[model samples]
Target: MSWTTPSDVVALLRKRWDAGAYLGRPWEPVAVPLRGPRPGELADRFGEAQDWVRRWEQVDLVRLERVRTGGRVIGTNEIPRRVWIDTFEGLCALLRVGPAARRFEHLLELTGRRFPALTGWVTAHPMKTLEAADDWERLLAVVRWIETCPPGLYLRQVDVPGVDTKFVERHRGILTELLELRVDPVDGVPRTDFAGRFRFRRKPDYVRFRMLDGSRIGGFGELTVRAEEFLAPPARRIFVLENEVTYLALPETPGAAAILGGGYGVGVLERMDWPAEVELVYWGDIDTHGFAILDRFRRRFPHVRSVLMDQDTLLAHRVHWMTEPKPTRQPLGALTAEESALYRDLISDVYGPAVRLEQERVRFSAVRRALGP
Candidate 1:
């Protein structure tokens, strides 16, 4: 029916709770806009419409307000015009979530008392607060610890009674939001890295580099050292390949190191000070993401050179071209003129359909040739 059902009226109020309306303000007389039948609609489905109105009147969730109407078939009638949600308690009962609303009220009271600053956060994310009801106390404790203690202690040093380092790490995302309100930029922490942002000792970001001169590098032929340790040694001419086998198989070049990582989550590299100094040469697939990675890497190190990601390499491996399922079409600001041109071709369906030349599929000889002796 076109008229609002009891379920539909309940759904309207439920959306407000979903959007964190419960946390915003103390309960006031609130109303759900009753989109019931117009007078003409009432005339068409008179009996069915009366039953729909009766259902709203019977429901305890909402009080139906009506208006006296003059009609042709029915001499005079009172029709439900609006729905009123009288109180927050009624709202909870209507939604069948009384316990959750009580939990949020407790969190609000606690946040206001301990961290007056986070009251805004409480109001902003009531739905999240209720969702994390079980762990909300611990989340607040982590926030209090950061605010109370000096901002430079490692995350491990956080001495919350029950919560451990993994707990903080597990909830870094929500913690970042809570902690930001407490900690200022005077503390040396990056929001991108949770541990560093709150001055907690963090697990080192591994740099898997194959030593072209295994004898000189003083480690295994293929080594995945911490970024800090990688910086300890002087590195020159690092070849960061996207493909794993290709990174592992590259021939020894007197002063070169082959680097690789899964996916394009390269945020870990932001922690290191070494890739900035060394001559970085990237060889990725001839695709949009490959170019996007190259583009981002260049943003960090403008001097970083891209190898084997050219139109020529793509054309040479025409028979091996595979479709890039999802192509990134955003204009890459950091790509060089040539790299940007090739990226354009790859995304625009210029060279066959969704054409891509993966670095792994590139001939071994071509790779060796690119890494010229």
Candidate 2:
């Protein structure tokens, strides 16, 4: 009654085969012993013994271990002790995964001949290899291109036939693992961003800013400059805010620059090379995520100050308070003493869970007051 069926043994081997263990170690022999009904269980479920025989006969590819057991009514009888599938072929046949297994075998054989260094990788990522089995040819084609092509080319610049930007981007994750195995150390910076790590040209990052006091920018009121080329103006102040409306409506202040579009993008500003002592002000919503962003922003730009993100401002805008569905509870190590106290209150739900005040909710007069004369 509690016997492991023929289908169950096949399912078990199918798992291992799909996992790539079969081809991962090509020289190693395969052996899986099925756990069938014990001798005592067989005699107890003698009524279903005929059904067991029918299931056993169906799995003709596997070798069986049999035993003689006595039942009160059936007398001494021969039954299967366990089933052994010792060969890869037999396991594949029983599981009916022969086609997939054969493909994996071919892949292993080809890797051994063409890319012997990937032997360890094949052993480590059996499942990944199987998932990419269908795409293995295209994937290897890209790998081969990376190996031969000049370093620092953009993904699109890869001149390999049938290998395009989308093809490489879609397979970046696995390619990174595979690329690292074959790519020269001089060409790879594994610790950097994807483009840098693989020595490819990444899409350039740009800084969008508004010249607060003077129209030093060309054409438009705002200037969007590539982060690498954007020279920081020798202006006395730089104000960064998240809200577009507030950024656009900012009243001109002498010797100041307004950086719009805020979130956890302070890292991107690192390339801007801002002056060490200039007045840097950040204005964000009076919420957990806002403070969290400000907290991270300060780590890189420690001199950066908060303008309207204070307890007084939060209390003044209670009418505009809204729920922050998923608030951050981690301490903002970069916050000043006062700001840290307010951040604690919001997260602890002293005002209640998810309480927040958007920077846009504050009056323009309040903004001017915070910015100062």
Candidate 3:
């Protein structure tokens, strides 16, 4: 009959409730205009219209405004024109979301009572509050513990009764938001780095290298040490390669050490105090990003040299060349003329689109020759 039904009114309120509109604030009486049958339909389909009216009349949780209308079947009749839900309780009852709404209200109450500053956060993130409702108590306890504890403790050292590192890790996203409301954010720490943002001790960066002079640090020839604790080995030559296999397979040189380079993470080298006159050489895939990493590394160690990354090496291994999935095309200021030209050719697809020649793909004999006797 083109008239609004009781279900229609409930559906509209349900959408508003799910959107978190009515949960954050007290409900005010909201009157929704009802769509009624046209005058012609009121007379033509009197019985169906009456049944529709009967549905609205049966609904007791809402008030219905009526208008006098006349038709051939009746001299005058009161027809519903609008439905008004006068209370939050009435709206929840009509929408059947009472339990979930009550839970959110409890969360609001607890958050307001304990952490008044986070009350707005609860209102803005009602759904998030509900999702974390089961863990809200423990989450609050963790925040309280962090508030009283000294800074610089690791996540494992967060000594809440039931909260563990895994729990904090799992809830770091929400915790970061809540903690920011209470704690002062540390400078130079990105918000995404939850530990750093909250002043927690972060895991240390490690550098892995092997002493090729057959010398061992204590016992192990290859060792991974904290970047800040790494002491430069007494070697005249340092060979850095992105491929771990290539770094490991390097034949013993008289006074050379091999470092497993972590792509663009060559900045770790800056943590070490390199000795004077030690030649630093990097060998990476003959691709744009490889040259980019070499460029970034050379920015710090301007005297660093690159091996097996020239046009000769790339052309010699044409059979092993593959397409770079995502090639970097940015200009590299630290590259030599030859390296710059080769980098240009790679980005411009001189040989083929996005060409790449991995260091491991080069013949070991060729790598050995590059290393020199």
> Residue 257's C-alpha lDDT in candidate 2?
81
Query: Which one wins on lDDT?
Result: 3
| TM-score to true structure, per model | 0.75, 0.88, 0.81
Question: Model 3: what TM-score?
Answer: 0.81
lDDT of 2 at 42: 61
- What lDDT tens digits, residue by residue, belong to model 2 across residues 1-373? 5667876776777777666666666544454554555556666676687688767877778777777776676677777767777677777677777787677678777778778888678767867877888778778778888888887788788876767888777777888889888875444366446577777787887777888786675666678878788777647888888888988889988888888756765667754556456888889989999999888888877898898899899998889999997899987899999999999999889997789999989998998877754
What are the lDDT figures for the candidates, one per model? 0.79, 0.78, 0.87
Give per-residue CA lDDT, model 3, range 1-373, as digits (tens): 5678887877887787677778786568989999987777778888998998898899989999999887666568789999888988888788887899999989999988888888999989898889899999888888878877888989899988889999998998999888888888799898789888887899998889998889878888999988888888768899988998888899988888988887876878865657335899899999999999999888888889999999999999999999999999898999999999999999889999999999999999998899864
**What would the TM-score be for candidate 1 when compared with the true structure?**
0.75
Q: Which model is ahead, 1 or 2, in terms of TM-score?
A: 2
Give each prediction's root-mean-square deviation over alpha carbons: 4.3, 2.9, 3.8
lDDT of 1 at 96: 92
Model 1 CA deviation exceeding 4 Å by range: 22-24, 32-57, 60-64, 71-74, 83-87, 110-117, 150-157, 185-192, 206-238, 254-281, 295-306, 332-340
The candidate, 1 or 3, that scores higher on TM-score is 3
Which 10 consecutive residues of model 2 have the lowest summed lDDT? 184-193
Q: Candidate 1 lDDT, tens digit per residue, 203-321?
A: 65687766776645554566677766656334478777778888778887877777785557455565666778888888888888888888887888788899899988988999999
